[model samples]
Target chain A: MVHALGEIHRVLASGGVLIDLRPLCDRWSIEVFSARETRHTGHITDLPPGLEDDTAANRAMHQAEINGWFIREKEAFFPLHYVWDTASDMEKWIDEEWVDFVGLDEETRRATRSTWALGDADSRVRVKVKMLLTRYRAIK
Target chain B: MSARKDPEGNETKHLHQFADFAGKRVLEIGCGEGRLTWRYASASALTVGLDPDKNALRVARIDRPSDLADKVHFINSHAETIPFHKETFDIALLAWSL
Candidate 1:
């Protein structure tokens, strides 16, 4: 994509502003995708935990990698947080809306649901990200 | 060992190996609970501490030293994009921030 953009910019007018914006959302975005049942019960936090915490390091590395791609005119960070409080909120919406779904046993679902209620899922399910937005200008 | 003393009798190791910190803008990128933020605030008059987690920021602000807290500003933000003027910070400490 970077190569394609560079090639396109080569033919553009002398002063062209190339604004590239992409959400740096990670796997935790799934919290918003949980079923209504999971949502109401706060079971959405049942998502598997990451092996390593990659928040700080990943952000830095991503910025460095993108900087390598093009000449950055300006760079900024925007922080955001998304939260879903209950299992039913997630389970109802997801289960009813989807045509195909995977079924879990009542016991397992109950266990997961309880875990979310304890607030353990707050950090486990929610993802706070700093969106690194950079505006780059082609250097001829 | 440096021989720098605060209002108290405690001696601080002034890292003169670096430039002056008094009245200079500073940024504590990580600032986990203001452990080092308080340390730096003791010397520098103007310092800002940033962290993404609100809970951590609360702890840093509350438990931080009163003397240092007066000089430090705590903000809930990430390191990737610092919310300040460019080249505003003379000394940005990243104690375990990376």
Candidate 2:
């Protein structure tokens, strides 16, 4: 979160306006994703089926938390947008689905640039989705 | 369940500690999920909740209390790049986010 805020500060003009949102005790329930429509889903392969990572949302809120350096704006209430048209469109959940995090036995870890690579690269899949939209702002 | 995390479950008691929010602009840093945003908004302050985790913010926005919707602002931005200038807010509340 701190790394994200530094980027925002880099671009924001001095004395800019910022509105932020933070969660105290919150958890997210990701809707599951699969290549097939509930075909008795199972961990057939080490790789997850699709792409899911909401880095953009994290960047936004992280910037908001550092409002101490900026001029605070009128506090407004905005909710996150959680509805995506389809399952494949939900990108936030893709990382957990696609990445095979199993510990490398030995030779496999040295064979590739990523320690999390799948045992069978042929079965790997990558997909994107918009799981949610959060509200945040920092204006110069 | 949301109200349970309040500094004190009782609104009146928490309000006493948060009296700085009265008619002031408030920025809540590290609001895990805006559980307090709902209460602070109802207490007569314009409050904003700032969190970096989108997964958590997703639920915060989904279940925000409807009654205080107009009084608060939920932003997906970070604590540093807040859209405002320095010294702009009357009060900044960070509940155990150190």
Candidate 3:
């Protein structure tokens, strides 16, 4: 990650800005059933069952570690909600995009399907993703 | 289960607050399918979208709007080894790349 930052620093011109947007380490949590239900039940804090590396934590640590190379000018948190047309779509995304994570078991999938079912019998799942937006200036 | 709607234009809204691309040369690394390119390409003087994924670049090229044909250019490249010369672009945007 530091190497990538160095490459970015190298490519940036003087006074150039680097917009580093990534998932915040400790801020990531999944609310599987429903917004209200998840809110009342509390978010799942544990890392997904099969993830080998702590990506969010590593990203946070990387940001701290690379602070010296670039000067942070602004920072904010953004909420990104990834909504799927159906529970199957959500499962496909998890299977393909999030191959590293393994906690999406049958029980969770079933709950998501049921929770996202519409009155008209439509099924749509929404996943909440938290992103950290940081703007940095390359230190000459 | 209840139906849910996808979030609308949140990224663009956030991006507008952070930087202005007017008349600036922009280089977007890891630009998958040019999702954000079309949003700012018109405002930017010149926009170059680069990604290592050939398939994604192909999709981006096919989807390129006629108005932005001259303004935006898609290239296949990696972030670690950018092909352009030093100081080529005024603003380098990674957007969700990193």
Candidate 1 lDDT, tens digit per residue, B1-98? 11111222121232222234566666666676775566557677677877888888898888867666567889887665556653455555444334
| lDDT tens per residue, model 3, A70-130 | 6778888877776666667777776776555433566666666665564234434556666
Candidate 1 structure quality by residue, lDDT tens digits, A1-140: 23334332443234333333223424222332233333322222222222122343345434534655335566554544333355454344435532132223465457545656654434222223333344444344
Q: Which candidate is the best by DockQ?
A: 3
lDDT of each: 0.46, 0.43, 0.67
Off by over 4 Å in 1: A1-140, B1-19
* Model 1: how far residue B42 lies from native, Å: 1.6
- Provide DockQ values for all models, in the order shown: 0.02, 0.04, 0.45
Judged by DockQ relative to the true structure, which candidate is superior, 1 or 2?
2
Select the stronger candidate by TM-score from 1 and 3: 3
Cand. 3 TM to true fold: 0.78
TM per candidate comes to: 0.36, 0.37, 0.78
Write model 2 residue lDDT over A73-108, tens digit each, in one string: 343322222323333232323334323421122332
Model 2 chain A: lowest-lDDT 10 consecutive positions: A38-47
